[model samples]
Every structure is written in structure tokens, then in C-alpha cells.
Target chain A: MGSIHLPSHEARLACRQNRLTNTAGVAPGYLQANLLILPAQHAADFHDLCLRNPVSCPLVGKTTTPGDAHAVQPAGCIQFPDFDIRTDFPQYRIYQNGEYLESRRDLLDVWTSGHVAFLIGCSFSFEDALTTAGLQPRHQQTGTIVAMYRSNIPLLPAGIFTGGHCIVSMRPYRPEQIDRVREVTRTYLSTHGEPVAWGWEGAKQLGITEINNPDFGEPQVFEEGEVPVFWACGVTPQMAVEAAGDRIKGLVFAHEPGHMLVTDWTSNDLDKLRPGII
Target chain B: MGSIHLPSHEARLACRQNRLTNTAGVAPGYLQANLLILPAQHAADFHDLCLRNPVSCPLVGKTTTPGDAHAVQPAGCIQFPDFDIRTDFPQYRIYQNGEYLESRRDLLDVWTSGHVAFLIGCSFSFEDALTTAGLQPRHQQTGTIVAMYRSNIPLLPAGIFTGGHCIVSMRPYRPEQIDRVREVTRTYLSTHGEPVAWGWEGAKQLGITEINNPDFGEPQVFEEGEVPVFWACGVTPQMAVEAAGDRIKGLVFAHEPGHMLVTDWTSNDLDKLRPGII
Candidate 1:
């Protein structure tokens, strides 16, 4: 607890200086975001893609102008005063013409003047909230990545970003705990609020044929009386980008799945944005 | 409530037979929808547009196949066994190359084999819920149309659906009633749920300079001690379609403002779709 509880600025500085190579369970209480950078030509479609598929993509903030690395200012984020999108993440996944190329420590060398960056809320931000509420996420207990699967549920298509199933992450909890879990997650709207599906039968409706095998993260078994709860995963944007299939210009960039950009916003800051209240 | 309390099937039948010339205050218990029909080529982009701008365009249902009017079957909507999209609405506005041409009683004359239809949830469905909860809509009280404005809040772009401000409906409520109104409205997810802004100051931040001169709908005076409450309106989809400009193929059809497609669903059915409950 002592080492993991770093201020948001120090955590981001660690990533910037390459002192922290991965963000898993680091900087508790701060909100972490999935990063996606695309050429300006696809910016509109990608923005629409996030809006259309909000449960999966939940856009936290986006650059105010294309190629301006420090354009987005997270609501109430007042730390560092100098945030650069190009070199602020622990690691980045580079894609060329919609195909995955390689992972890089920073985008300083590859970023184009035409690139637009989008910061999407990550589920990691709410895990702390769940813990605070006394519900432990199974992945944290097992010290493994959360299990993810490609569901049959089709994403509403947007322009060149067309024809892909929604990607979801899964956790198992007793039926009695489902309501409480949902209530906790509901507050984190920017970070994919609430489970889209619950119970063993629910996954079949989403078109995932196998429970034990997952497309991303490690698979887990359900305990007795436990049901599988599913949520729209941040990986969905990556899948949407891949689905673009050669329609993309030269390059697109994203954080390696589970690796993220830790922002100055606290999990509590996101919870304050509860819908219907404002 | 004698004439307005007709069941869903009876209400739709009245419209189909041209017996009931208008839908407002008719079919009080049933859900009504804003209809939009477009060429099959623009179907994917349109779907994305709805997904991207869900608050403004809550997609209740869409055709399962291109040109198939009977494709969508809302879960538990068993009232209307002989529904047809072509003649079920009281009136429709036709747009060619994104220009408003004329309003017609039915789409039968303009129907094409290359068309797809979307049924967007309307705030009209939630009015009954508000009434049931003892909060009367001001428009109903004034016997006028709901006030709508084009706010500066930019919509997430999708394909040809680019650069349009969100069009919101305004209803004034006493400051004490705002919470009750929000609570009742929050239950209707298929319909636009909850007010985006409350009070005069909130409207200005949304980029609405003149609340009195709305781009659509009739304006009303705020009662003493009443605050301006703004909710995302269905007119948003129309603005997005218009923003597409010449990109739209040949023709697009939508219900005239205040005219809608009465469906077999009840207001309770929509309220039951409460987010995070699943």
C-alpha cells in the first residue's frame, strides 16, 4: 500500500521517465486511461465510433486540436501543468495500415503531425472503488490479467470502422453480490459503467461459445453459486481500429492492453460525473 | 383519459387507417418513436451515428435487414401483431439530398427496396412516466410543442454525420421539482434519460446564447422560481442527417416534429430497461 499510493503527478512522471514500465496496480486512487492515436483523417469516424460504442470506449478526453499533444485537459485535472501525449505512457502499441507492428516505449519517434490522440477511461480506475466497497476483483486476487472475450454482439458501424463484435471482460461473483458490484461500477461511467450481462447464460447471448478460453487476458473458473458478469472492454476500440482493415492511413497507436496512461484525476473525480445529476 | 387511453394496437391501427390524424396525447400508455428511413448504403453510418449520439438519439429498435420493415421485434412488445412501418406514422417529412421537400401522410408513395428504417426512442414516452410520477410536462400544460434549441455541444462524428450541435428540448420546472423530474426520467433509457442541464446558467455553458429563440419547437416563458431544464431531444438525429449534406444518397424520411410512430411498447417497458440492472 505504501509503495503503490503515489500522487498522480509522480506516477505520470515515472511513466514519462521510463521508471515505471507497466501501470498494473500502480498509483492506486488515480484514474488510468487507454490511449489511442490515429491520423486526423480518421479522427471524426473514430470519435463517432467511441460515441456509438460508449460502454466499451467511454471517452474520457480527446485532443482539442489535431497534432497538439497537450490539447485535452481532463476535467478538474490540474497536475503537472505540462502533459504531452506523445511520450507520457509506459508503453505503446504501434499499428501500420491497421495492422499491429510493434510495441514502443514512447511515440516520440513515430508520432505524425497529423495524429489525434484520444484518452479513453479504463476499468482499472474503478477496481479501487470496488475494493473500497469490499469487493475484490478476481483478477487482482489471482494476480493475473482480467479475462476478455470477443462477443457476438455487433458494434453499430461507423464509416470505415465497420463490422466487428464487441469485446468484453468477465469476472465471476455470487448472485447475491451482483447488485452491489453493479452499483459500485455504475458510478464510473467514464470507465465502462456496470455489467452489460450477468450469469452463465448471459455470455451465450453475447455469442461467446467458451467460458474458459478468452481472446485476451487470463481465463478464470467460477466458484460454486457464482455467475459470470460481463462488461464492455476498452480493447473494443483496438478491435474497431483493426476492423478498419487497410482503410487507415499509415499508422495508429494505442497502449498495450492493460498498460495505460495514469492521469491526475482520482477515481472519485470520475464518480462525481454521475449521469442525470448534472 | 377516455380517448387517449387506447391500447397500443388500437392506437397504431388508428394511425394506419388515418383515423387518428395526430399522435400527441394519443395512446397515453404506449411508447411512440421518432422514425428515420434512409438508403441501405448509409445504413451502417446511420447506425454508428445513433450509437455515437445516443443521448440525442436513443435507438429503440432498427430493421434487422435492409428494406425489411418487419425485421425489428422489441422484446415483449406483443400488442401490435400487424405493424407496418410504411403507414403507421401520422405524418413524415421527406428529404432529398438533405433538403426538406414536403410532408406526407405515408411513405408508401416514396418507399424503395433500398431503404432501411430506424425507430428512435422519443421523450414523449417518458412524459407519461413523469405524469404518473406527478410531474406534468410544461409543454402539455401550455398546450404547445416542446421548445428545442441547437446547443454548441458538438456531437461525436460518424461517417457523413459530421459537425452538428446537439439539439435539446427545454422544459421549465420549479427548482424543487427538478430532482423528481430527473428521477422519473432516468428510468426511461430507450427514451432520452435525464436532463443534461438545469437552470439558466447551465444553458449558456452548452453554447446556447438565446434560449428564447430556439431553432425548433415553440418557446415558453419560465414561471417565477422555475428553472430551465434541458434534455437531449430526438431532433438531434435530424440535425446530424442534415449535416451529412449532399453525402446522403437520394432520399431520407423522418416523422414531422411532434408526429411519431406509435409502437406496441408501453412507457413501463422502456422504464424497465434501467441501466446497470442487467
Candidate 2:
């Protein structure tokens, strides 16, 4: 039962039935998304935050209207025909007043009609493109989640979502390969396009003090002459929620870090789904 | 006085003093923006509407925080150092509870700390590019404002901003010129990038029944083999506010059509200022 080759629908069904726990490599060609559900009252501000900080929080799709669990395409087609927002993700992390509560297998008991669900594009989609281009990420070779850090890069604040910094994921690449790496990643605009910074000086500029001790995910070992390249991480919205302190009232739900929602869209759909192309 | 060759700073000064009213050809190389100011309570929802419909409401610069009037860059630099949002636009249209009130020379009496200002990218930036590429819009040749019409294209609703259709500006071009037209406009991403529809059949698909009788701007007289080419218009947000029908409360301010905010950024700055490039 290797899940990496499963189609998107079957992979999502496995998560719903509690058969799959980690979604990193599952549904290889399909896009994976980070989930963030908030009360309808707070949906606008969070949506604004994502739009303002698109590098870190590239929005892919969301419920057609507040409280609708089904994510739909702009043309009104349901992106995942049989998808259930509450049960499709392998794990859900619940937070209240900006403090973590606990992780749940599903949101059956927690989901309310008042909640608005947002699906953010994840880096996995671009990683697939990179691998196809023969630039396998270091974390993939090491069998670990990509290293993540909180950078000093400030997010453009929106209403209650204030006082937050960007969260970034790191991958080691040879200095000479940097140009090609950027060219490959920049095409996946909705999934954190291009590297924000690179090299030791770049990390220090972002105020990252300990390169080995990441704020999230496993640490990676860098080889000689290989500089670190940082991409805006999907975990940024989570940090924004945490930084909001008591300003975020009620409950907020997000997919547990590495366990993402496998979407029906593929890397091939990227160009057509761009913001203004339609 | 001639303003097409004026520097951005000086052009903004002229606008502030009412010395320049129509910004169509002013500050030739600089970017111009459509203005939308709402009470803080509606800011998030309107912001969401803009994000959901980037082709029509491409947001470029916005106030640093709610209730602040000065628009700033991502790095905290004031986009126009000596600019004042309330008086900088040549004219302002006032709205209350989704109904048009009256036009004003300035918002000195209406502006308050509870208002949030947003600057949406206008098609003028791309029109400049099209002209530079020898694809001058028909309106420029005819010496009239571009023709605009309300299309049946449904907008992605957010919160209280619902039931709105897309508004588009039209320019007639020969069938063969569209490819070059799209290439020229697509690079100006923040401005309404590329034509959403073209030709008679394309316009019909958008449910635009009255091509010769535009809802706004003077109707264009098409020549032989010339077809209507439509691009998303900045006026869509205004229509959304109108369609909200009392869902919008307090006061709303927008630039009178064709009177926009000229900023310090130039066409060359576009690629660097794109989302996530920072």
C-alpha cells in the first residue's frame, strides 16, 4: 500500500477513513494544500492577510461562500467532487484565542456552519516540478520534512491579523544551480514562487540566528559550497494566528504541518489558474 | 499646462492642488491607481473581494494600517512621500449605504480615523505599455475615454460583498493584433492583465447584449475587421459596492472615474514589485 502513486480521489478517501496519516509524498502529481478555517467574522481579515503576503500564503481555492465546506473553481465547479473538508485531511490542529488546543483525526465535532475554510497552495506542488527538473530537494533525499524558520521579514498586517513575521522553508543548492532553481520554481506562482533569499548572508539578513535549530520541521545538513535557499513556507499563517494573541477570538483550525489536503488540480493546471488569466 | 512629461512627485503635487484633473496621460512612465476608501469595518471584506477578483480589482498599494491614509511600499517606504490621500485625487465620488451621494473636490470634511484607504491598479499602466508597443488603444486615437460596460461575468463573493458582476473596459483592435495586445498587457500583472474577452462572440459569452451602448464611457466606433477587446476594469469594485445594496454602511469614497492617483513607481518597477518578488 505505497500511497505515493494513488490518484487524488483515492488518497483523500484514505485520509477520511483514517488509513493514511502523513500526506507528504501521496498523490505525487496532484497539488497539496494547507488548510485554515476561521469563523466567518474573521474570514475577510485572514483572506486580506493572505493576499497581502502572497509570497508566504499563496491562496489556491476556498469555500464558495462562508460555511460551505466544498472548495470550488472560479467557474463554479467543485474542485473535489466528493471532498469533505472536515474529514479529508489526515489531522487537524485546533486553536482557541491563539493558543493550541489539540490535534484531532477529523473535525466532525468541531466544524460549525459559522466556519469559513481556506485552502492555501503548498510547496509540494513545486517540489514535484523541481524533481522532474532533476533538482531533488535535500529533505527528500534525507527522508525528512523540509527545514522551516521564522524570518524577520514582516508581513503586511490586515485588521486582527497583525504583528507577524514570515515563516520560510530552506533547501540547500549549489551556487551554480541557483539560476536554474529559480527558473523552475517561479512558474508555480500559486505555490510560493521563487526563492526569497539565499546563502549565509541571506539567512542572517532575515535574522535567522541558528541555522541548525529550525522553528519547525527537521534540520538538514548542508554540503560544502552549497548555499541555503529559502522559500516562503505554508506555516506562515499559523505564526500569524499565534502572533495575534487574544485578538483572534473563537476557534481556528489548520492542517497539522506536513499533513496536507490532496487537491484535484495538478501542476499542469498552474498556468490556467493564475489570478487574472480567466 | 502639459503634464505627460512631469515626474511622479510633481504630478502628485499637481493633483493635490487640483491643477491636473484627468490623469490619463500624466506622468507617462509612472503607475496610476483607482482609489477606494471605506469605513474600517468594511475594509477587510472589500479587500477580500479585491483579492478574489484580481483581474477587475488588482490591488497594488494600500494604507499601512486601518484608518491610515498614506499608502506605503512593502518595505515601509511611503509610496508618495508628500502625498495626502484625502486631497490627492482630483475628485472623489461619495457613497452611503450603497447609494451615490454627490461628488466632492476633496474629502477633508468626510475623512476620519475610522476610514481605510485602498489603491487598486488601473489599466492605464498597461495602456501605456500597449502604446509603447505601437498598439495604441482605439480610445486614444478617437480622443475619448475608453468604453466600459457591465458584464454578466459573476464575481467571487466575499462576506457582505455579494451579487456583483464584472465591469470591463473595451478597446477595438484588428483580429491579428490581439496576440501582441495580450503579450503587452500580461506583463503589467497588477494592472488588469490581458483581455478577458474579444470579438463579437467573446463579448456575447460574457452576456454583454449592448455593445454599441456602453454603460460608461463613450461607445467606440469599430472599423472594418475590428472587434471589441475587453479588459477587466477598475470600476468593478464600485459596482460591487453599489450591488451590495445597503450591506455597505457608513461612508465610502472612490476616485471619480478617469481621475486616479499617480505614484512614484514606474513601468520598469513593475517586475520587481510583483507579489512574492520581494
Candidate 3:
């Protein structure tokens, strides 16, 4: 229950049995995904929204049919088999009519035939890749949540999903290290590839008025030579849902921010150049 | 009318005035694009299809409103001003309810209140870029059309638009030059990016039964020590339209093969590493 080296399936088993409640570093090399479930009626529109705003919502898996628990394959880079949507994650946040209701260990009670789930690529997987490449993610070393900001960039609108400004996650690095960081991250296109913005100048272009004060997550102090580097955040779709409010029909469900669904597929599987490794 | 040197706008103007019927290599540094026009009824689904199959349909610009002649700005790398959808392309292939009508020099008489235009990225611009870097595209060097084939890869389906097998354009190069070619082309994400397949082994995986006998364009005789390289072709969407058949709601229009709409933006603008160069 308290092991850090559990495999992805075992981690999900722990969550299913109520032994583990969060999945931060569990199965470190494997991929962890953000879960978003909506009523069947909104699937096509949401699918279009993901397509239009690929940087913010890089969809990894989705249900073939509404009410189906298994993730559907669509010429995916990696395949995850034998998983249930109802209880894979450590926690699930339920929203009805676009309003937050509550968070629970599982969605078994709320699960219905009308639900369609979307598994979006999470940035958490790439952080491990970055660390392995000798680039420390600022938030992890300082033991704080990564800073997140709402930028001026507008997302492409689809159906009822009138996308709002883009949400970006921030990290700090010296100017010289930015190129190496960009190269490493560029390989993982599914998980917010490369830094979208670098330094205060880049941030301002995205209309991030303040660097230290983030809209979400805890703020961190930067080193003397560090500049803020921003990547498109996976939390963007959730924020868009919240911003859409009444426009969203029926209910929506998402993974509780830090509690992602760990997959058997490794993080390296996301790299296009390196294939069949996992 | 047949000049080799002209800006993108002037080449487009020549096409507009029925003075030019071909656009290959005319605007050397500028970008050339594939055109697709459809009715508003199928716009959302077609847009979703393009978004899903970006490799095959790298959308550069789209009409803001149905039947509008002007392109909509969406933070694109290039901007084309004072362009008319009805006659900007050298030739337009009209398809009514998914059935081929005929090719025409202009669409002024056929243009109606229900059509929407989409400008897709063309591989022609990248060929020029490759030549500048001392890597010649096989077909361009031979003074023939680029070899193309239908592959087994199916595009992700959208509403009323079931995707067909991907169509890939082929070029030949020595095995050693593959890496450099990939590196140079990787910068143009909007223009089919890098090679999807290289050599006979790669082509066979895409279900191309024969290398010399291509599904479209002229067959090429490979030079000694040369391997065939494949990049996703812009013709893929047209194939999707053909595959959809009666599923397509209304009339659709496309640029005739080898004839394209030249844009004011330079080919360098497509490179993310080199920004604002246009």
C-alpha cells in the first residue's frame, strides 16, 4: 500500500481497494493521464475542442462508445489494456451542469450509461523524463506545486465549448539551459511538448500579467539567474469547462488535479522517434 | 505568365487573371497551399477531421464565415491579404454531393452563399527549402510530379466524415541523407513535418504493395543506393472526401493536383525555430 515502486496496474489496484489515495510518483517511468468524463451528448464537441486546441488538450485515449469503460484505440502511440474507467484514479472530481460537486475515491455510484471518458496526456510524465536528462523541474526540487497561469491566448471554439484563455504551467531555468530543456521536452509532444513561452518577455506575450502570482498551484521563489519558462498545462481543459459554466450540459468528471491515472505504458512511449520500446 | 521569379501575391494575381495556370516554383521563397471548400453544413465535421488528421491536412487558414471570400486570422505564422477564394487558385476541381463535376479556371460563376474555404499546407514549399539546404526533392530534380500512393493508415473519423487510408507523397534519397532530410523538414509541422516512412520496409508497413507502381503521380526510377522516403500528402483529405462519397452533405471544391494557391508568406515562416521571417 505504501510502496513507491509499484507498477501502474498495481497502483490502480491499490486505488481500487482503497489502499492508496494519491499517485504522485508511483510507477515513475510510466505515463500518468488526466481523466475527463462527460455525458455522451458532448463527446463530439469535446473531441473537436481537443483537436482544435492540441497544445492544451492532447487526448491520449477516449471511449469508443459512450458508457463503455474501456479506453478506445485510435491509432494511438501506446496501448493500455484491461482497465476500468470507474476506479482507476486515486480520486475523481464530479461536476454537474459545469459546477463542482464533490471529490471521491471512485465514481462507481455516479457512473452511468451516458458517460464518455477522455484520457488526456499529463505533464507529470515528462517531469520524470526531464529529471533523467539532468534538468530539475523547479517545483519538484522545492517541494511545491508547479505555478500555473491563465494567459491571454484564446482557444478555438467548438460547439458549446467556447474556449477561453489558455492555461500554462511555469518552471524556472537559466537562459542557457532553455535550449536543452526545449529539445528534451520537444520529443514528448503528447505531454505538452517544449516550453511554449520562455522568460518574462515570452510570458507577457501570452498576457500573463504576473509571474510570481499564479492562478493555480503554489508560488515559488526563483533563483537569481532563473527565468520563468512556461509549458501548456493539462489543467487547461478543466479550466475551460469551468469557464464555460452553464454552456456545458449534464455532468462532467475529471481527475482531482494531483491524483492522475497511472498507465502501464512508459513515458518514453510518447517520443515519436523511439517506438516499440515499451 | 510563365516567369520563374515572382512574389506569392503576383503569382496569385496571375492565376486570378487567367494569365497563369501553374504555380510550381514561381514564388521561390513564398509558401504555396492546397485549397478545400465545402458547405457550412459539413464545416464542423470537416474542421474536426482536419484537426484529427493534421499530417494529411495541415490547415493553415480557414474562412471566418460561411461563403466569406477572406481568410480568417488565427495567430498563423503567415498572413495573406487581399486574396479571393473564387479565383486565387490556378484551377479548382468542383465536386457536387461527392461526385466529380469538372475542373475550371475560376469559381466566380459557381461561388455561392453556402461555401466555406480551407487553406491546407502544401509540400511544394518544403521542397524549395530542401533544395536551398542542398537536398533536392527527387521529383523536382527529375522534372516530374512527386510520386504518391494510398497507404493502409486510416485517419481518425469525425461526424459524417469517415476518414480513408492516408495518401503519402514520395521522394528518393541515399540512406545516409535521411537524418538530415528529417531534421530540415521537422521544422515545418504545418507542411507535413518529417517523413512518415523511409525505404521499402517503411512503405510496406503503410501497405504500399509496390514502390515503383504508385497509386497517383508518375512512377519513378530510383537511382543506385537511393531509398524511397514518404511524407503524408495534402491529397489525403480529398481521398477522405472521396471515401465519404454520399456521406458528404453538399458540394466540395479542391485545387487540381500540381496547381496550387501561392501565398504571400515565405517558406521560412513555416519553421518554428525561425519566427516572424515572413
> Please, what are the lDDT tens digits per residue for candidate 1 over residues A172-250?
8989998788778765677876677778777776678788999977888677888888887887888888888799987
The pairs that clash in candidate 2 are none
**DockQ of each model vs. true complex:** 0.07, 0.02, 0.03
Question: Model 3's A-chain: what TM-score?
Answer: 0.87
Top candidate by lDDT:
2
For model 2 chain A, the run of ten residues with the poorest summed lDDT: A71-80
Model 1 TM-score, all chains together:
0.53
Docking class of 3: incorrect
Error of 1 at A77 (Å): 33
Chain B TM-score for all candidates, comma-separated: 0.89, 0.91, 0.89
Could you give the fnat of all candidates in order?
Answer: 0.13, 0.00, 0.00
Interface RMSD for each candidate model?
13.5, 15.5, 16.1
Top candidate (DockQ): 1
Cα lDDT computed for each candidate against the true fold: 0.74, 0.76, 0.73
The positional error of residue A190 in candidate 2, measured at the CA in angstroms, is 8.4
Candidate 1 lDDT for residue A176: 93
